[model samples]
Target: MIVAVRRSLRRALLVAGRDLTVERRQPDGLVAALTFTVTLIFVESLAVGPVEARRPVIAAALFWIALLFAAILGATRSLERELEDDALDGILLLAGGRDALFAGKTLALAATLGIVALAGGSLALVLFDLTVALPFHLVLGVALGVIALPPVVVLDTLLALRLRARALLVPILALPVLVPQLVAATQGTAAALSGDAAASLGWSGMLLAFAIAYTGIGLTIVPAAIE
Candidate 1:
């Protein structure tokens, strides 16, 4: 079992490295995600009307909106490219197994979304005067959001592709499942801003638990979906 686990991890890394290399060579997804994030932050800030002065929850709301959409865009593009080029079958053929392919794709999706979240979060904080009493908590909230959200997106995208479902259904399918994560991350950020220790602790626990759960689900289920 230990050996199998190690092999899976190594295979995942190789798959992830291949995806990363492809992304670097053709960066449409990366460019689109970052652009969407920045645009969402700027436009949403205006809609909220003065970030620092708004309700504490506003900051969390804005950040999550950008991060969520950014992640969606990246995941969608990654999968769409595969389907259009029929590269997914090639990936599976080369990957040696479905588990490795899932791991690699999950890592790639998460890394791209993570970068956009961190960049957009910093910019949103400055634009909206979203100064929280517990800045560390705010940072942690963002980190966990990236960690937990990607697997859900990747798996859903894969499932949708398997079903030949429309692109619109991806969010429709994913959002219901993503609620716990979205609520946890948003409320956790609010708690951090307000210095609510109890809320922070609870939400943080939820975030960690959900991250682990979703990642495990991705590994366990995506292969089945592919097969």
Candidate 2:
């Protein structure tokens, strides 16, 4: 059983590696996502005038919104890339199990989103000059948001596949589903910014709950979608 598990993990990693390699070669998707995130931050900062005044409320919203859009765009293009190259069908045939495929794809999507969040979060902190108290809590909240985003994105990617008006449909479908996560994340960030550890913990716990629920559901549904 251990050997079998290892083999399965290896296969999943191989799939993820292939996806990452493709991204590295083209890089257009990553570039576009980063560009969009930066531009949105710039616009928001301009509108709000300063990070000190707006950081508490705007920071969380800004982070999640940028991540939300970036994930949608990135996931769409990643899946589309496979479909365009006629690689997905071949992968399905070779993998023999939809669960394994889902695992692989989901991991890849999560990794991609992590990178985006890291870059976007760093830029937001620097550009906005956000001076939130309880730095640890703020970091923790952002970490939670990053952790929660990918599986939701994986689920979205599966839904977007073969759908008409997918670009529009993805956000419409995903944003509503992601509201709970956004709420928790936003509240947690706000608390952290205000130096309220208790409030941040409450929201962080909520975010963790959402993450757990989403992961459980994604594991079940994503396999079917992949197949």
The clash count for each model shown is 0, 0
lDDT (Cα, tens digit) per residue for candidate 2, span 77-145: 888887886777787777545555666776777777778888988888788777778989987887777
Off by over 4 Å in 2: 1-8, 51-53
Structural similarity to truth (TM-score) of each candidate: 0.91, 0.88
Question: Which tens-of-lDDT digit does each residue in 7-68 have in candidate 1?
Answer: 88899888788777878999899889999988987887787688342566887877887788
**Which portions of model 1 miss their true places by more than 4 Å?**
51-53, 94-96, 162-165
Q: Rate the local accuracy (lDDT) of all candidates.
A: 0.81, 0.78
Please give the TM-score that candidate 1 achieves against the real structure. Answer: 0.91
Worst 10 residues of 2 by lDDT: 95-104
- What is the lDDT for 38 in model 1? 89
- Candidate 1's error at 55, in angstroms? 3.0
